[model samples]
Target: MAVASLIPPAPATGEPQSGCYMAATSDCGGRLSREHYISRGLIDGPELRVRGMPWQREEVARFSPDNLVARILCRRHNSAMSPLDAHAIRFFLSVEAGLKHAQRRSLSRKSRFYMTSGDGLELWAMKTLASLYSSGIEFMTPEHRFRDFEPPMERIVAELSSPNPCSIMTLSLPLMQDAHEEQIGRRAVSIGPIVDDETGELSGLLVRMHGIALVFNIDLPDKDALPETEIARPDMIDLIGMDRTSRIFLSRAKRRPEAWIVQIRLSHPRKDPPAGRSDRGCNRQPLRK
Candidate 1:
């Protein structure tokens, strides 16, 4: 689709459009600028760009409301708060193609950011891996899974991929809020494993990511109070205390991965049996047991 066709006709000079868009919220401040759901930079980024153009425009155009969607925001919100929105939009674009790219890289580089080899973690990661796995929710994907952890990944992904549920326009705050509430009780309420080095055993709990649990330490108070010692199994990660400055480390094997599959790409050179062949897989097919 022509880039111009993707962009909505410019609101005639100053005439504002209806605020019916639910993704838009009323800003008491002033007129909002036309924000590209996907960052213009990302549209022209290195990994995704080809010949100075995004190959995914065709895919993104499908989601673009008139080539671009406009939401009313005050200058503050648009410039300040909108960074999150901008980042999220880019992530959505990346994951569509990046997921495959990330997976290929994992096979070689091995990322610790959103992967685990333990059986218990397979189910958790499969369920929560899609959401931003970093301690803080910075990234987002179109497949924002882990909204609820009670259901299995297959069930949830199947539901999400359905045409009815996949439309971005159909999503609203109330719906998202409702889904979040439902998952509160069922969200992964435990830390799977903790792999730590000399910088004190990094202890973090697994919260839902996309639809998986990414184990990262929470930066809370009293980090200095915990004993700086090493532990064996990740199960012992829980033993560590939570405190301020409880640094959360997101370890990614390859900074530039080729696909998005979340599983430990064993880096240990000792290939006794093989890599990606962990004994602690789960009964679920998503977990690869």
Candidate 2:
């Protein structure tokens, strides 16, 4: 189930046409170019493993990161998304580094904190969702459905490109639970959509990577809707059982005025795909640190 207002409906059948999905937007121009719906930076080395996508027998297979590209956005629109991709890349890199440090025997509590632009993270999520749709992936996928629907592409684009901040979605982490964390392999990544039980509209998107999982809401709720004290609305479904997110701001301290702050949150143990989420065998080499 998708929220109304995606692309224009076809003249004969009234079905949404996938042709140049972003044609209606003013920011779209230049030649149609390949866009990595999923940031290539998220890929380490040359490839990454994916599961739960149709066409795979075991629901798991490795593909070169470049294979994820699609001729979705025009060259200009796609290039405009570079900053968001960089933010997301910095975030994952920071996560890998922090995780390695956390496992160190002589870890210090003070070293756990990090920071990045929350706005950039949110934009990354929106960009990811738009790219998926533009790449021919439907919002009403087999894994999650109510009624067939499509999102308002223009609105998603406007929200993503606009300068003013908006609460399009929230990213959250599970409250700790190593019992489940230990089961999820660091290379695991899962994504699925969510539908509103009542409205039957595409409500959110769930993305689980490594041990941590995050959900990005689809409705684009008001930034002020979430009071500073609350992480998520009680009525919002716990799509990934990891919704405890809160906003934080920091000021430069005299001790490390030159250093920037970034917050790295990790979660694990959510339900894995049909393929399984167990750690890789000891004989197999890790994809990356």
Highest-scoring model, TM-score: 2
lDDT of 1 by residue, 2-94 (tens): 001111223322333343121122222345455433233433333222110122334212222233324433343335333333332333333
lDDT, candidate 2, 142-227, per-residue tens: 55642254656678766654545343666533333431235343775556666767786777666766555555776646535532
- Cα error of candidate 2 at position 129, Å: 0.9
| Decoy 1 TM-score against native | 0.26
Question: After TM-score superposition, what is the CA distance of residue 6 in candidate 2 from its true location, in Å?
Answer: 20
Among all windows of 10 consecutive residues in model 1, the one with the lowest summed lDDT is: 236-245
Candidate 2 versus the native: TM-score? 0.64
lDDT of 1 at 272: 26
Candidate 2: C-alpha lDDT: 0.50
lDDT (CA) per prediction: 0.25, 0.50
Model 1 residue 113 CA deviation (Å) reads: 3.5
Q: Could you tally the backbone clashes for each prediction?
A: 38, 7
